[model samples]
Target: MNAALALHGLSFNYGDRTVLRLDALTLQPAETCAVIGPSGCGKTTLLHLVAGLLRPTLGTVSVCGQRLDELSVSACDRFRGRNMGIVFQRLHLLPALSVLENLLLAQHLARVSRDGAAANALLDALGIGELARARPAQLSQGQSQRVAIARALVHRPSLLLADEPTSSLDDGNAVRAIELLRTQAQSIGAALLVVTHDRRIRGQLDREVVLGGAA
Candidate 1:
């Protein structure tokens, strides 16, 4: 199967420091993959490259068969807005927006027509339907994470990238988070890439890519 995400001869640097170097990496369609490494291993950096938030110093990032490097900055942003879903550790929900409205904003930013029903359905699927009208400040940590996940999937993106998604939760919540991420990705037929150093999540994914120095 063609790769849902691919990095060829990827290398990234910041001035004098080289943060990441991958000869090749690819994630199959609907695959759940984890990128594991210690701090500074470029786990998050790799996601940034894939999402077009950062340009690779010396390689190409291919997503859904298109070369992201070939697109202009604005074009790349549009492509990501339309096809990618990113869940940050911070959950970045606008505190003032209700759960449902937060998701609507994602659709608007993507320039896609609003689909309130689809947004609500996603919230229901993520087990956050009851919190639809709740403000972000009113949610528990787990609920906040669920809202972030629902927001990411609200548009039914083709690829989902999550950074340290379960790092803040207790072991039990962490496990639930991983399962939710995996199950939801499968249901949506989207490739999932989670970057974290937490070994608790290792067993939940279909494949793993270990970054950083080898022993």
Candidate 2:
């Protein structure tokens, strides 16, 4: 089977500082994996690299068989918008857009047809349908996070990348969030790769990929 994501000789450097190094890594279709490590272990950096938000100093990142490193900057952006869904650690929702609008914007930016029905269904599935009109500022951390997840899934991306998705929630909310992510990803046939420092989410995933640790 083709890998949904693959990295070989993946190393990232920040000027004189080398932050991440990985010989090989792969995540298969419909498979869920958690990337766990200590602070500054380059877990988030790895997510950025895979998402095409950052270019690796060495090695290549391939998503859905396309070599991200080989694409032009504009081409990479278009590919990422169409094929990848990223739940940023900061939950980068536009403050001006309401819950529903934020999701709609994702569709618009992806250049896909705007599907209000699908967006509404996703918000309803995530249990945030009632808050569709609420702005991001009005949401609590958990609510905002859920909205972010819904936004990520609106485009039905082949690969979902989430960074520190449950770091702020309590145990209960964190578990719920993880389950929601898994269920939603499976439903959409998207491979899930979540990079988090939260050990609480380790056992909740199908497998764990530890960075900056013994092999």
Candidate 3:
């Protein structure tokens, strides 16, 4: 089978300054790994590259056997929605929409058929079924974080990318959040790549990739 994610000689630049570079990286389906590094080491940049949000200045990125560099802008967006899910550091839930609507919106944007049953099932699995009708502004920090995670996984993406997923949680909630991500990703058979600085989570993953310098 094709690797869930692969990068070769990948490098990204911000104008003349190089921000991130990786000679090679690969993650198999259903595998989990953490990308850890100091500030400005391109941790988040790597996630964006894999998610097709930014193009690499050099080399190639392939997700589920398809080359991201080869896809057009529209194709890339569609591909990302169907194959990848991202939990950004800032949870970008639409405050005006209810929790269930946010997940449905994700499906709508991905061009997938809207399935409210699947959406509600996912919410129930995350232990936030009752909160499905609540708006984002009404949820607590932990509740909001769970909603963001459910939104990412509602589509059953093949590759799951999470940035600083546990950054703001306490010890208890941090562990719970990581477990949720792992369980949900495994259920969907997606390779999981988490970009985080939290030392508390390093031991929980299958392996850890430590990045050094900004190219």
Superposition error at 31 for model 1 (Å): 0.6
Q: Which one is best on TM-score?
A: 1
Q: Could you tell me every candidate's TM-score relative to the true structure?
A: 0.96, 0.94, 0.95
Query: lDDT tens string, model 1, 24-120?
Result: 9888778999898888889999999999999999989999998998899999999999989999988999999999999999999988889999999
Candidate-wise lDDT, in order: 0.91, 0.91, 0.91
Question: For residues 147-193, what per-residue lDDT tens digits would candidate 2 score against the true structure?
Answer: 98999999999999998888889999999899999999989999999
lDDT of 3 by residue, 3-108 (tens): 9999999999999999998899899999999898876789989998999989999999999999998999999998998999999889999999999999999998
Stretches of candidate 1 exceeding 4 Å from the true structure: none
Error of 1 at 95 (Å): 0.9
Return the lDDT, model 2, position 96. 89
Compute the lDDT of residue 31 as modeled in candidate 2: 90
RMSD of each: 1.3, 1.6, 1.9
Task: Rate residue 23 of model 3 by lDDT.
Answer: 93
Colliding residue pairs in candidate 2 = none
